[model samples]
Target: MAVTSAETARPLALVTGASSGIGYELARLFAQDGYDLLIAADQPAIVEAKQSLEGLGVQVTALQLDLSKVEAVDELYAAAAGRPIDALAANAGHGLGHAFLDQDWNDIMHVVNTNITGTIRLLYKVGAEMRTRGRGKILLTGSIAGLMPGSFQAVYNGTKAFVDSFSFALRNELKDTDVSVTVLMPGPVDTEFFERADMLDTSVGQSKDKSDPADVAKTGYEAMKRGDGDVVAGLKNKLQAAMAAVTPQTALAEMHRGMAEPGSGKN
Candidate 1:
């Protein structure tokens, strides 16, 4: 697709995974804050999201592309050829809930590529630009799952761990620059994540106390705007993160098993 010039004078924010859930909320916040948007998701539903965001009186360009491929990340960046992105929310992720060995190799690779490979590629490209310009803010959606070993959701958790670690490293490296990189470690939120990960039968998925996607997004957006290094979304998640810091890995893994192991809810 050809890159288009920004149609408005507002700042531009590039948000991935913006078709729904937290990504959708982040895009809305940006619009509310007066930034025009470039939003992408693997599904065509992103077009509908674009329509809704346009209602907020900001120009929006929606792209439908799977971010699991390197080319797709390149295409997403190319699509913003003429605009200086004031913010980037790399919220795209994939999850597979089951025994790691039981998952398909293809599925595992997609999760890695989407969550780690593609995310880093886009960040490198956009981040380099931001560095040269001496300004920008980045929000990476990590997870509280990253703090533990997700028993049934192993690969998903591992990828988030990489994201969480990478965001902090990047933040430190860019500390002297005006660009800020912040990771948002949110606990379970009411989103399609559980359904798509095939975790609907698990205790965590079935729990009624999941965090609200809007609330999670608001927390991350506020932190990003403030240039904070990282923010864990909820009070419960904050406690979990604090505890995970002192807990042993074996115990954390076992604790995750109770909530995420297959058929955990049934048990």
Candidate 2:
């Protein structure tokens, strides 16, 4: 009697990284679409974000999680016992600047843990559940940067590369099922992500002239609702994606050097 099954009339969505930026906007968009939300992010801001979603008339659950920790994935799914998630948006990600060689081991591990290990683990479990139910939608937050190379932000871009690639493969594998996987590949967004990631001083991070997270999230959600395999959020980023197809890998890395370098002003 306690659990709300997936057969319910109202859709329920679980969004990671809902504390701010694109993740926060996705929760709002889903709420407007009448989906109840289970939002998770490591930051304290999830409290405010959840309150905002509740104000939109959606049932909201917020959790503070260090998603970088491997154990957090199961805990997140367990927390959803009473709710059958119709959709899962894996939108939490972070960036780090400075030369990869010079970066702290722990910091790099933290990013890798969250972006790679943790994300894939959750996706696997959630995908399995959806497969059994024969219904569900999943969205992974990827980046246009995944197409090319990242200089100082190498690890971040590499992780996104994994996400985008993994999403495509998973989508194909589930082609026979009702479950759909969408990879939201967005360019820069005007959010506090850069500030918090400590990349605000870099050229790419300092680029305040970025896409709105709300707009980006809208594109992703709509695409997921339609079961589109992938979507690039901005026009400029779309062009970047096009170039990535033809450009040489070495050339792309060189191009990214100035942007990721410190004092480059990409925020």
Residue lDDT tens for model 1, 100-124? 9999999999999999999999999
lDDT (C-alpha, whole model) for all candidates: 0.94, 0.88
What is candidate 2's lDDT per residue for 55-144, written digit by digit as tens? 998678788898888788778888788566789999988787788998999999888889988898888888898999999999999999
Error of 2 at 136 (Å): 0.5
Best-matching candidate per TM-score: 1
Give residue 186's lDDT in candidate 2 (0 to 100): 94
Model 2 scores a TM of 0.95
